[model samples]
Target: MSRSATFDRQMLETAFSEIDAVHRSLPEATLSTLAAEVVTRVANNLRFAVQPDMVPCLDEIDMLCNALLSDDPHAATAFIENVQTKGSSYETLCLLYLTVAARRLGEWWDNDDVSFYRVTVAAGRIYAILRILRMERPIGVPDMQRAAAFASVPGENHTLGITIASDLARERGWDIDLFVGLTHDALVETLEQRQPALIGLSASGRRSMPALTRLIVALRISNPNARILVCGQIAAANLALVGLTGADAAAHDFQGAIGHMERLLDLPTGRLI
Candidate 1:
């Protein structure tokens, strides 16, 4: 059965008002990034807040991902529909299957297991599915005081980690803007325009530290209020590394990221409900 909306319309309107204020102030170089992030945070959580969904197996995820990369435009959509018809919930198809498939696609790109173009095409399908899923969900509130953006170091060849981390953050109720495949200047420029409250950066190895450090500095200079979290292989480094990068915290895994993110976004009243 279809459920009634579980949101306060007034609250959403108030949030949009704040977003509009930001939009009006900033030159709109990458308008879609900010808009999509807001929508995703609202759409992904509202239904999940009401009811949970099932998860798909690795094989199933691979099948759907393969379909997504097929030449037929309808293959991916058909696969999603078939899964739903088989009694998998819409929530399952989205958060479980489609989301995981994104990670898989990113994995291939990172390891050079597949061509970047192929991975990009597959990733686009996953995004399309997510957007379509949004249409079925009721308009909802973000329930956070500020939004976040996740990005890989400008030239980092390994980006799957940030993609996974961002999805995990969104799963845990963050409004997240993702910056991938951007040049150093472009990433910094787009970030300045978005002005996110928090920024998550991923670096696979020590080789990326210089670029990573530079990025944190640029972000700090440009977005003074934003908290930065350093993750991926570099997070395993000692306390000295954190100070060197000037990141507020470093986390090697999901739980640590969650804990640090919470502390960063904390209010006197505690984390927003």
Candidate 2:
């Protein structure tokens, strides 16, 4: 089937259901065979969505699979190089797959001490599945006592990092209030009214540093007890510099941000509820 023709939501759900059914059956040999089949099916589907012109670049896909599934450092580097040569779509798909595969790997590792190779293989198969599936943003439950909020400084264009961090906090039982593209004054007013325990700021560009600093200072003056966390590409690249800004903590990623928040609030490491 043509990629577009095959990508109907119902069809995708059915395919996923079949994959899940096979997984539930759980005979070792059958599971392995099903995993390989899932990869083949998704790869075939991707050949259409990605265009026949890109079919010859299956080597790049294989390299990405090997990197995530086999822990082959060389393959990982080659995959990244290939994506740079190919286009951003390749890299986007790679990231989507990596996210899914990482989740699966976590589950498998939690269940048993599988060899790293086995973990990689499972990750590769899950990555293939993720490439062909649509992911939905999970709805967050509200928590009144430990609410969290997101804001971006003026001129800051990226919000994905902040969105993910808020989602993580929400998943851990924090009442999350996400405010993308808010100006400094608006963010402070919202924080003052909500009285949330934490305010998260994200900035992806260097030009945003001054505005972010101003916001942090404003927040501190308005709410001395509220903790502030800063994160994003810019923050990660200049951790030491941001640390000097009087923010309570700087997180490199969503996981790190959650961990830092847990420590600050005296919550258990992985359990905020």
Candidate 3:
């Protein structure tokens, strides 16, 4: 039998409470209808739940997504507040929203229900929220002297996946360096100079495969012992393809990436609770 994950009841309650605020003004019939729609959407698509017990229900996730995507001036703030109250850590929250929440909006856009303008607006709001949250906290000091570097494969415009992983690594007291928009040559030069203990590379699609393979080859030549992990939309789906790039491993998500980092470095993993 599968073991039950340890889940904090208080965290689930807190999430529900925040969601309750949004439902307070709706009539019973309206609330029921909305809840049904939320469940349907979640069921029809892929949803990432952090823990079986603590996972936000369909209604709660739907509420949060609506708040972020809606035109209301206060909606984004409310969504952030809900996440802040329910999420265990900054990194975890970022991963959850980056994947689940963002994907939900993208699905709507694909159906022509959500416009490009609204999607960009919601993304900006999330970026601002993350900026404020990270800035409010004191800079982290590395627990171990080892350092890690993160960057996207050349030609991939989206680097947020690695950025989120970097933030989590920084929080865990790992020396983290993030580079964006770097060509393969530039990345190789930087990696050679840093010779970090670990390196993470992100690639968004199959088009990045060739450049990624070249970058990985250069990375191995520069720092033969550095633990390399490939991550991103394509990495999560096609892990075997990542191995063809000569990396040590490919992360399925931010949380899985952290676990791999701990294992590769011989460091103890942190408990989510």
Candidate 4:
């Protein structure tokens, strides 16, 4: 059954208002980042506050994602029809469908069963699906007082960790600014301008450590009190190395990062809810 429209309507309106404010103030270069943060915030509010019924079971998600791996358009069509027939909540279903399902697709690439081209195509499909759902459903909005900047180290091309961390941070009501493939100087300048409460840097390779160290040093100069977190394959796989990067903590995954942030900020658990 559809949720009562009243709460979702209010939440979405509030979210859009905040997004409008962000658009009015930030540089045009940052608009895309702001847009992504707004989307994450709205989806998160829908997931936690709205509590839509008819959430897809894990098995159902696995099946749908597997279907998406195939070339047949009929599979996607059937999956959509199934979701519609079950009267699943669009916001909840699409949020999980996009994030968890995309993760599954990534694993397939890891296993060498899917090509990057195929993964990119599947991701686009999910994005398109969510775009359409965004038009039709009411999204929830939560208060965002704190901010975080997430980025890969200069020259690092890895984005999965950044995407996962961004979603997790936004879910916890932190405004997220994503920096992609930026030079260290450019990133530091952006950080200085945003002055977020936290800065998260991800690197898939160890070679970027030198530049990452410089970035961290620059961050310390610009925002002395902001917590720094190092994540992604290198940091998560090598816990001891995080200290060398000057990060307060290292996280292998989303929940770990959230826990680290909570401890650093001295906020109680479940603060976002």
Candidate 5:
């Protein structure tokens, strides 16, 4: 395995082990406090390797969540703006509290209704970390003819999925352009201008499907030759719907999507419009 992959796996394993250990030895309240501290420490460590601007904001999120656990409504409300400014990741942070609540309340993990607010929060933090890496640009294209652009649907907040997909594309030397949130008009304009060989859209929720479909239709009408692909939670959950919505294909996972795109583009019939 690559050094980065090995390191990531080791870190995740350590984090999970630490979480389990903390749950065993600490009181429910104490475990909640420790989780906040762990998030703060992890965020700080990540910032040391990346941007310092993220440290303060991430720390504040930890503080706000700590306050919420204690039922400090005032403190919770105070951090609302900070949370919103940070985007959907903040929602994931809020979800992290659910894990603590579950452990403290003696809730069963297998219960489908058992909330995973904490898991979501952790996922958000992961998203934030990945975003700092700017994982979308293709790394080593040999020539302009081999270049490709990548982007996501506008108003689409599920950037981590695209970021992962982009990282893989970059490693394979395909040029990528990652657009986080663009309206239908902006995306259409972009498609007309760049005329990329492949365009990938990331959607996290069903709410974004209508706009996604419209965007795909617009792209098909305006740039019928461009390859269109969709991936992420929404697409995976509704693959049939997504495929039917005019996307040439949908990838259920990041690596799968990348492989699909490469294979599709390699075909003789896959000429760019």
Candidate 6:
């Protein structure tokens, strides 16, 4: 997970303005201190701005969370579509409701409130819903910052989640180059050829960590500007993953993956959402 991320447009603009001022006065000074402070403040603001709105959606999200783990697959889709029909934009549906539900399932798994099997099924349902939603928009040229690649660790075979993660990112206007099943060398070769701005890799267990770390190192050398995000099981130890593997960020769900991308690239706030 990126330690510094901000979603507020005004705050970013204000911070940049301050940096511009400093540049004018002390052109020779290094900006490490200023950058750190601004990043921390802006990151804190994301929590402040989003948490209150989350309360209003909690009841609906909670209900949807349960539906996700239910036996009938249609239950989760019907519930999400019903809420969407009640006036939630597709963007809001993905960014807020589905995101909250995903996190809730994660917490349940963490606390042993739900079994891995149930949570895995529920997460799969969410991915299916995202793929269905992708058809709502016309695909277009990917913005420089919106192009990315999705892959799985070299020896790991679990890719259904990351496939849907790519779809969710697409629904949010990303151009995803999926290399989920390719071997380590082939994946690196393709990434080096395409040079996507972001890369997302899924890892299922500690066994995948060594491979994931090595891939990140290769990316750092081969595609120096490519920021890597580790998702799935490895995301449980995000900070450690970043420190140990040289990954720029980690996310457990699609929304956070996109959030990290925007923050990592410092993209403008105006979005298709």
Best by TM-score: 6
Clashing pairs for model 4 are none
Best model number under lDDT:
6
Q: Write the per-residue lDDT of candidate 6 for residues 11-40, one digit (tens) a residue.
A: 323333432343344222223222222222
TM-score of candidate 4 against the unseen true structure: 0.45
Please list the residue runs of candidate 4 whose C-alpha ends up more than 4 Å from where it truly belongs after superposition. Answer: 1-146
TM-scores for every predicted model: 0.45, 0.44, 0.45, 0.45, 0.43, 0.47
* Displacement of the residue 8 alpha carbon in candidate 6, Å: 30
Q: Name the regions of candidate 3 deviating beyond 4 angstroms.
A: 1-146, 271-273
Steric clashes per prediction: 0, 1, 0, 0, 9, 1
Model 3 gets an lDDT of 0.59
By lDDT, the better pick of 5 and 6 is 6
Better of 2 and 6 by TM-score: 6
Better of 2 and 3 by lDDT: 3
Pairs that clash in candidate 3: none
Candidate 4 lDDT over 112-207, as tens digits, reads 787654554454344434433444454332123456678888888778778877877787787788998787667877887777777788877567
Per-model lDDT: 0.60, 0.53, 0.59, 0.58, 0.49, 0.61
Q: What shift in Å separates residue 60 of candidate 2 from its native position after superposition?
A: 72
Answer with 4 or 6, whichever has the higher TM-score.
6
**Candidate 6 at residue 65, lDDT?**
79
| Model 5: per-residue Cα lDDT over 12-125, one tens digit each | 334334333434553444434433433332333221132343234434545644544332233433343344444533213322322223233222223533234453333223
RMSD of model 5 against the true structure = 18.0
Q: Which sections of candidate 6 miss by over 4 Å?
A: 1-143, 269-273
Q: Write down the worst ten-residue block by lDDT for model 3.
A: 1-10
